[model samples]
Target: MTATQAKPRQPDLKTSLPGPKTAEIMARDQATLSTSYMRPYPFVPDFGKGVWLTDVDGNTMLDFFAGIAVSTTGHAHPHVVQAVQRQIEKFTHVCLTDYPQEITTSLAERLVKHVERPGEKWRVFFSNSGAEAVEAAVKLARNHTGRQHIISTMGSFHGRTYGAITLTGSKTKYKRGFGPLLPAVSHVPYPNPFRPPLGSTPENCGQAVIDHIESLFVGILPADEVAAIIVEPMQGEGGYIVPPADFLPGLRALCDKHGIMLIFDEVQAGMGRTGKMFSFQHFDVQPDIITSAKGIASGMPLGALLAKESVMTWPVGSHGSTYGGNPVAAAASHATLDLLEGQVKHEGCGDSLMDNAAQVGDFILGELKGMQDEFPFIGDVRGRGLFIGIEFVKPDGSPDGALRDQASMMMFEKGLLNLDCGEAVIRISPPLILTREEAATGLDIMRGVFQELK
Candidate 1:
């Protein structure tokens, strides 16, 4: 009856994971699909309605990842579905760059209004994916500041495009064979408190990174020649790491001192994923530009680059994307933003989905911290709202990626969908509409998996 009193749960699965039907489809996929594609688990989805996903094997599972945190309003919410249908009925593509598109223009206005930054004018540029937004950010920062050098944090994931990949400091696999990436990009350590970079303690890691960049200015890269310092306010693929409290603000002050642009790659952490409208809100900082995509349009393909009006100095015909702001995607984004901003409310636990995320996130984080005492492998539990991670560790205190991999697969088999990030962490970024009951369900499965691991 009460939120905390909800019972532990398990999906009444009809078949084993990757049943006959799913296996056959996977075989076909292996033969036909590109070799570069990676399947974390053998979950072949039939359809998803709300927080539940039914696999091709006819087994139902609670979706904990939300298509890697893209379905902001959950899978196929009626509002987003209806918006897409209406836009499709009228027309689909019309290149928002050249034409005057009403849906995109209005959506841009809505985005500007929700920024919550007073007295600062903003501009929006639409793209089809986060990588494109990063590309645009790179160009805009360079063009606006008349500088070429860029700085990014180690273990940050921007995207896979040339500029984005160059900026990305995560796994080398993402950059494998993609030699000759965009030049003049340098990486500095992100101020992760749990495992502080270069043996620095949590309290000083933020300042340490800032000091390193200051040293860079004096020795290698001059401060005046750097265009931007891009970062993920809270990292995504790099194990869902949250930087120190002073990290973002330190970067902001350094950029201000150097006349360098600060870019926040919010592709995974934006769209109300972190309780607030953006992850940057949690910290006392304002970025010169923001790039977002993952959860923007509630499953539709849409990306956005929002910058201060002064930084958006790129002239017309400077850059273009033919299908960036397609009407259908714009419509879906409009509905998604409406729900996020509470213009269209879902009658659930709280005033808005953002409220639900904060409330539920607090509950889950408390539960996870308790689990750490019981589970020796659970070295760390950190998050903002639903953007959570559970790090596994070996006896020697190093990351236990092997055990983390096993736990993720075990959860999937038990009818709970999840994924691993960083070296040994489970990411718990679910849909915004996830209920307390749903949270309990996943938490129960997580408990079982850790118990088994123990």
Candidate 2:
């Protein structure tokens, strides 16, 4: 029997999770997959549908992480499944080096139209993951400007690969044993009004970042030597830090003044996860190149480096990926995009869902803020759409990862799949398709944990 058929008709939390079956599987996994990649959850997922996952022990988990923001349209979404099934029967792989597939071409054309950069044409290069997209963005910046240096902000995460890891600044553990990294990548402080680097107000933090970049160019890396400035519209693995409202436009101005490329790593924030087609759209400031991956294909492996036509000047043979634009992935992407655009007229992300996110997100934030007032451990609550974070603090207002870790572990046993990020922030990025009622259920579960801890 198929997985869905063999499973119980509805979710059941029987016999405490990691029940004999799941424990056995996890034991085997420890010897197989790298320790670094294994998750902390004890229950192993058997399959998923909609916003829920059925674990090996038959426990149903409300997936708040959304595969870390990849399953925006939800798990096993029908449109995505049908698209992939159709594509798989025809052909799965095609060499872009040999002949481009129609699926990829369609995706690229739609992306260009979606970008709508002022007075700028757009192009896209397909990739297999967010890290590859970051690599492409950096390469495009270097080749376009004939410069060597790239600038990223502290408390930012581009990806895990060499170049992307070099750009990431959240933790040194990601780079400690990796040895030498990409050359000439510089870091500046990101605008965090809550804990300002130099005591700047939130209103002025945008200009502060701009000023810092300007000083860096004059006193550190020269303008002519800089290629691009990469930033997350809303920092993801970096504590869900949302910069000042004026930050993106200010960066755009500085980049334009210095002939430096502006690259937005939207891997974690794009694809309607933030209630907009793209997070950059929220700022009305366009980047020369934007990299996306996590939610693009709703869990299928896919990424794209979108650039204004002028910046996408690499020669025909400059770059290519064997499975980058695989027909199956492209079909999944098309289906995912259609669902996002509401063309499929699906149950997810209709006007009802988007409105619900704003409504419940506000409630959750308010509740978290109340908790902050009661418990000194709750430091902050901030996010856009459903991509929210609750950062923790000590009584002295310093980061206290230990307490946060304890709270997270407590939630895990309670059957929630939340993840921690940045210094001591808890991520609550559930699938975009998650309902208002479902969010309330999960938030109440979380609130119960906070109450217990208090």
Candidate 3:
């Protein structure tokens, strides 16, 4: 088949979703695994290729969520697999302390180029996941600045670690029982146009955030004591909420004014998921540090903290990870970066894939706007590139988490995999490699679900 003709497709359901056998497997899993970490879906994915997954029952399903925004190069890309295969044949792991590997050095070099600052050099510290990246970034900032306080927004979702969770803002549910969190963290309001707090409009939300943070410095923590301000250029789990045009640049200015390091958590939105190398690129606001993990090394566990050289000065024995830059993982990352940089493609389709995201994302967003008009439950729809969200609200446009739950279940039953976020937002950040036609098909399926709910 030709390159275009070989594009992956949506799921073909010959039988009901989660058929009897899949349900049996999931039920067995539920009985054995802890409920806290296990969320049994209707499908048991056996394997995936490109944009489609074949479940154990031999059903092919479209992968819209892309393993929660990872797999940007799409599942099992030939080059990535080959790289991993080649590495395993040679050697799997060599302790970094004793033997530094070429693959790790190459991956770090590639990362430095991607996250370079205009006038300064860059460095990276590797980890196993996004949360670890955030923890490392916060620690780096603390060590570099000699400050104890960190600032985050109220609707953020950093990670689950004590330090990361302390920096997260979405409350109670994730933080309820986990007490004695890392201290000296305060939250400012995150900008949300659809349901602004204190009756503010979208246009003014950026200024409100600035004012709120400024008030904190005056009343709570002093600016010099604040080590870093961690934020998502586009909030991921907090509804894929894209701040106002001024939000990021404004925050950058505030960080500059206060001499606090700005950290961008690109864990979910980086690596072409936002149709760019990074979401921050679209906004022209450069963060002092960046935390990235998902989509960095395809599906393997890898996260990195990219920082300006000035803030990267940690004394020896400050912090380290045993498997942070494992050679096997680094080989995967090197191959993944090669694909992202257009070195490997079916037919030079990498950039075209980004263009596909913009075109298809525009159509999906338009369809969603139409749906919002028809269904009052849809309070708003906003995002850049392919990282989209649909916020649910009451008749008065306040958050309606219960209604969102109902609608999500309705969609799930109809063979779509969607994730709920914030209080009542539905996020649709699919893989970067999704074709225009596949995106339309997913949108159409979603529209049908919304119509059925209406």
Using TM-score as the measure, which candidate wins?
1
Please write out the lDDT profile of model 3 over residues 195-273, one tens digit for every residue. 5654578789877888888888899779999999999988888788888888899999999998999999999988766
Residue lDDT tens for model 1, 34-54? 999999899799998888888
- lDDT of candidate 2 over 44-122, digit per residue (tens): 8889988888887788877889889888777898878999999999987868657978889999887677786567789
Q: For each candidate, what TM-score against the reference?
A: 0.97, 0.94, 0.93
The TM-score, computed over Cα atoms with residue i paired to residue i, of candidate 3 is: 0.93
Ranked by TM-score, top first: 1, 2, 3
Write down the lDDT that model 1 would get.
Answer: 0.90
Listing every candidate in turn, what is its Cα RMSD in Å to the true structure after a full C-alpha superposition?
Answer: 1.9, 4.3, 2.8
Better of 2 and 3 by lDDT: 2
lDDT pick, better of 1 and 3:
1
> Could you give me the TM-score of model 2 versus the true structure?
0.94
In candidate 2, residue 126 scores what lDDT?
88
Which of the two candidates, 1 or 3, achieves a greater TM-score against the reference? 1
In model 3, state the lDDT of residue 237: 87
**Residue 370, model 1, lDDT:** 95
Model 3 spans > 4 angstroms off:
1-10, 38-40, 346-352
Each model's lDDT: 0.90, 0.83, 0.82
